[model samples]
Target: MEPIIHGILLAFGLILPLGVQNIFVFTQGVTQSNFIKALPAAITAAICDTLLIVLAILGLSLIVLQFDWLRIILVVAGILFLVYMGKVIWTSPAANNKETVALSMKKQILFALSVSLLNPHALLDTIGVIGTSAVKYSRQDQLLFTYACIVVSWFWFFGLATFGAVLKKVTIPQGVFLLFNKSSAVFIWGTAIYLLIGLWQGAY
Candidate 1:
């Protein structure tokens, strides 16, 4: 019981941080009024996250745990990917062009799945944190933890998408919106740097 509670808390802790998914959702919300479009993105991400969490629990995480060097490589690659994505978000047009860039449902779904599945940090979150945390529990407890992770993924993506949708109501200046975008970029870059530093330290 205690482990289940702890697992839930830890899952929340892991998922609540600002990351690529959150940034994408928030930007989409601010730039577009189509909340329905955002649903596919969030749902796609949730599916990917759930799949990865299941894979982690089923022993695929061992591949990550066994290869020390792979962590460093993944960390480096993740940082680069974050940095690149941040730049793209920073340069994205404002609400004026929202109609033009508002993706089709199929494209949005594919983009979300590609981004979530390809992200090294997502793998780390599932395999490194969730998988390892579930190892000490019985099979039932492990299942509970896995389900908890799925819940966390669903909650975060849905909550963030909703928040982004609400931001569309604000009558802020375009410049302010651009400033928010830049700030999000900075946040992503900062996280990338932190990850890189951790990888460097661990390598020594």
Candidate 2:
């Protein structure tokens, strides 16, 4: 029970922040025509999170943190991906347009993968925090803790998507969603720049 509680709280603390993964999933929910259409992004994100959590607990975190070259590569790739994602988001059509085509299933899965796996900060957090936390547990306790975190991740993303869909039903102005796209793009770009600076400073 302790492990379960700790896992839930830690996972929530990490995931509750507004990051690229969350934004993309929520926007898909808003832009897609229906809940089913929005699910690919959510599911992809969940699966990625599950993979990360399992790997972290199994000691991949320690392996990742050891090599400076590997860390640099991850940060570089993350920055490039964020730049491309920002451009894509900025040019996206208004959510309220009847003809606004949401991301295709393949694109959704790809985008979800990039946002989930490319972010070095998120990777470090999972590896550093969750990985370290798991060190205190063993066998069945470790499995329980890992499962708790994974479950929270799945539920949170689905809920985020659901909330976006609900908000879409509210008849907000088209321009508002357009502005959201633009703003989200700017935020993503800013994050990329921030990461680049960190890398330049050898913070990664």
Candidate 3:
């Protein structure tokens, strides 16, 4: 019971942060023609996150913690990727059209994978936080913890997609849409800078 409560709180704490995965999932939801259109992206994000969480529990987190060089490399790569993504978001062609081009399921899934799996921050959080938490649990408890975390990822993504769909039906203002895009860019860029600084601090 203790593990369950902690796991739920911990999972929500981690997922509530607006990183690339969360931002993209919500964006797809709000932008897609129908709420169901965003389903692939949300599910894909959950799957990728589950893989990371499982790996974290299986000891990949320990390996990452042991190697400072590896952490630095991941941070650098993430920074570059995020910068490019931020630019793309800011200049998205949908700015002038509420009925933006709808993405195919394949594209949404692929984008979800790139943001969830390839994002260094997501990887590190899984490896460090989830892994660390697992260490305190017995095998059975660990399984419970993992299960709780996975469930949160799935529900949170779906909820975000649903919220976006609901917002669309209510008719979001054009300025709000523009603001979301701009805010998303800023969030991504800010995350990159935060990761860089964290690396610098850790190195010293």
Candidate 4:
């Protein structure tokens, strides 16, 4: 129970922040034709998180993060991906949810993968925070902790997407959603810039 509670709290704290990954998932839900159509993003993101959590607990990710050059490569790739994603979102037609061409399943999965695996911050958080925290637990407790985190991640993303889908049903003006897209793009770009700064400062 201690492990479960700790895992839930930690996972929620990490995920509650408004990040590029969350934005993309929510945007997909709002812009897609229906809730079901948007699920690829949520599902893919959940799977990615699950993989990361498992690897982190096993200390596999720690090895990758140990090399300075490898970390640099990851940050560089993440910056480029975030920049490109921001542009894509900024240009998407957000004026009408029904009229907009939602991202295909392929694109959704690809983007979800990029945002999940490419983002250095997320990787570091998983490996640094969760990985270190797991060290204090016994083997059985570690398994419980991992399960708790994975479950929270899956539920949070699905719930977030569902919330966005519900918002689509409201009578909000199209301009509002368009504004949201623009804002989301800008936020994503800001995150890219932040990562670039961190890289420059050797914060990665």
For residues 128-180, could you state the per-residue lDDT of candidate 4 as single tens digits?
A: 55664555456788899899989999998998789778886455566765676
lDDT of each: 0.65, 0.75, 0.71, 0.75
The sequence of per-residue lDDT tens digits that candidate 1 reaches over residues 133-199 is 4544566776877787788788878887787788665554667546656665666666556556666
Give the total clashing residue pairs for model 4. 0
Error of 2 at 168 (Å): 0.6
Backbone clashes per model, in order? 0, 0, 0, 0
User: What tens-digit string does per-residue lDDT give for candidate 3 at 45-160?
Assistant: 99998999898877744554566576556556656766776686677533332344458999999888898888986886687555555554566777888898899889999998
Decreasing lDDT order of the candidates: 2, 4, 3, 1
Worst 10-residue stretch by lDDT in candidate 2? 92-101
Which portions of model 1 show Cα errors greater than 4 Å?
60-100, 169-204
The sequence of per-residue lDDT tens digits that candidate 2 reaches over residues 103-173 is: 99999999999999998857866775566556545578888889999999999899988987888745556
Q: Evaluate model 2: give its lDDT.
A: 0.75
- Residue 132 accuracy (lDDT) in model 2: 52
What's the CA RMSD of model 3 in angstroms?
7.8
Q: What TM-score would every model get versus the actual structure?
A: 0.62, 0.64, 0.64, 0.64
